[model samples]
Target: MDLRDRTHWIFDLDGTLTVAVHDFAAFKASQGLPADRDILRGLETVSAQRATEIRTALRQWEADLAHAAVPGPGVIDLLEHLRGRGRQLAVLTRNTRANALRTLRAAGLHAFFDARDVAGRDSAAPKPAPDGLFRQLALWGAHPDEAVMVGDYLFDVVAGRAAGTATVLLDTHGRHGHPDSADLVFSELSELTSRLATQPPGQSIGGPHASQKS
Candidate 1:
C-alpha cells in the first residue's frame, strides 16, 4: 500500500534510522551471553544481579555508539518527505530514550521527531512485544491500521504484526527476512520513499517473495 499515506509512522532506531553499528556478537560475548541467543531474552535466563549488570553494560555500549551515530542512507530524504507531508512520526526502539535522542541528534534527525513521540525500552516492553507500538498508537489517537512499523529486523516485523499494523522490513542485505509478518520490504529507505511518492495511496507495492516457513 502507499505507506506514506499512513498517518502514523513508527520506526526502529538503531539499524533502521541510524546506520547499523552494533556488533551484536561481540556485545553478546561481552555480556557472557550465547551468540545465538537474543540479548534481552538471554538476560532472562541469568541471575537477577547478573541481568542487572548486563543491562548496565549494554546501556553503556549504546551510549558509546550514539556518539558516533550516522543516519542510514536515504534516512534524511525519507524523513523529510514524511515530514513535509505532515505525517505523524515517532521512534520505537529497544535503546534507552536518552541514547535514542543522542543518536538522533548526532545523526541530525532529532528535529523531525518530538521527544514525546519517542518510546524507548523504558517506556514500554521492548520490540517482539507490541506494547511500545501500542503505546505510540494510543498517544497519537490512532488505530493500528492507520500506522506502519518500519524496522530492519524480525522483532520489528513481529511486533508490528502483533500490533495489527502493516510492517515493512528494511532488508538492506536482500535476505528476504521476516516474510510472513512483513507486508512489504525495501532494500533502501529511498526505495520506500520512491514507491510511496509514485503510488496511489491504496495501491500495493510488489515485493520479491514472501517468507518460507520451516
Candidate 2:
C-alpha cells in the first residue's frame, strides 16, 4: 500500500499538476451552455453547428488559460521526485492533448513527460471512463496494481477507482470538498512530496492493499 513504491504514476492535469484555471460556471454561462451536467457530455446533445461554435470557443479559451497555467503547490518537486525514481508517468486529462502539452510546457514541466504519455480528451473517453488510464498502462505494459492516479476531484477519484489504480486526492485550497473519496488524501501536493521523499521502501502510505483486483 505504500504509494511511493508504485512504479507508474497517472496524474490529472488541471488541478493536480497545474492550478485549476477553468471556471466551468463562468465559461458555460458565457457560452450559453446548460449548467446541468458535464460540459463535454452536454456538447453531444447540441446542434452540430452549436457544438462547433462552443468547441472553437473552448479551444481558444483553453489555449489562453494553458499559457497562464501555474503549477499547484509543490507540484514541481513532486514530479521531480517521481521522475528521479525512474518510474513511468502519464497525464490523463479532460483537455485536448495539445492544450495539455502547452500547459505542461508553460508550467515548466514539459521535460518530465514524453508527449506520447499525455492522454487527453482527443485520445480517450475522458475522466470517469478509465479508457485513458487503460491505454497508458497498456503502452507501458504496466498493471493497474503498479500505478497510482493522483487528482483533485470526484471524477478523478471515480476514474482512478474504475481504472483499478490506487487514487490520491490532492485537495489543495479545499476545492475537492469531499470526504473518504480517495485511497489517500493530501491537502497539498507538498505534503505528498514530503511523504514520498521520506518514506522508507515498502512502507505503506495507507490502505491495506496496492491496487490488485479480486
Candidate 3:
C-alpha cells in the first residue's frame, strides 16, 4: 500500500536526524552493563530502578557532549522540503525532552519544530508503545490514517504501526530493514525530499523493489 493521504510527519531524533559521538555501547559499559547499545534490552535485564539510573546517567553524558551532535545526511534539505510542502513536523524520540531540545538547538533544527511537537522521555511510554505518537496526533488534530512515522529504528516503526500511521524506515545502511513492521523504507532521507517534490502526500514514490538487503 502507498502512503496516500499522510500529512503529519513524526520523526525520530537520534540516528534519524543527528549523529551522536557518544557511543551507546560505551555508555552501557560505563554503567557496568554490557558493551552493547541495546539499551532497552539492557534495561529489561536490570531492575527498573537501576535501568532508570542508567538511562539518566547516559542522558547526562549525552548532554555533556551535546556539542558533538551533528546533523545527519540530508536532514536540513528534508526538513526544508517538508516545511515547503506545509507538512506538520514533530519529533518523537526516546531521549529526554531536555536532551532532545538541546540537540535540536545545537544542530540548528530547533526552529523546524515546535516545543509541543517534540516528545521526549517521560512524555509518553517511549517508542514501541505508540503513546508519544498518539499524543502528538491527538494534539495536532490529525488522525492515524493521515499521518506518517519517519524513523530509523524498529521501535519507531512499531510505534507508528501501533498508532495507525504509515511507517517509513530510514535505512541508512541500504539494508531492507523491517524491524518495526514498517510499510515502506528509504535508504536516504534525501530521496524522500526528491519524491515529495514530484509526488503529493500519500502517493508511493519509491518502487516496491529498491536495493535494500532485508
* Highest TM-score against the true fold, candidate: 1
**C-alpha RMSD values across all candidates:** 2.7, 3.3, 3.2
Which runs of model 3 end up more than 4 angstroms from their true locations?
1-4, 20-22, 34-37, 47-53, 200-203, 208-214
Residues 1-214 of candidate 2 have per-residue lDDT tens digits of: 6777789999999978998889998888888788887789878878999999999999999999999998888988888889899988899999999999999999998998999999899998999899999999999999999999998888888998999999888776666555467888888777778778877886656422212222
Candidate 1 residue lDDT tens string, 51-132: 9999999999999999999999999999999898999999999999999999999999999999999889999999999999
Per-residue error (Å), model 3, residue 118: 0.7
| lDDT values for all models | 0.88, 0.86, 0.80
Candidates arranged by lDDT, highest first:
1, 2, 3
Model 3's alpha-carbon lDDT is 0.80
Q: Model 3 over residues 127-161: C-alpha lDDT tens digits?
A: 88999998999899999988999888788888988
lDDT for 136 (candidate 3): 97
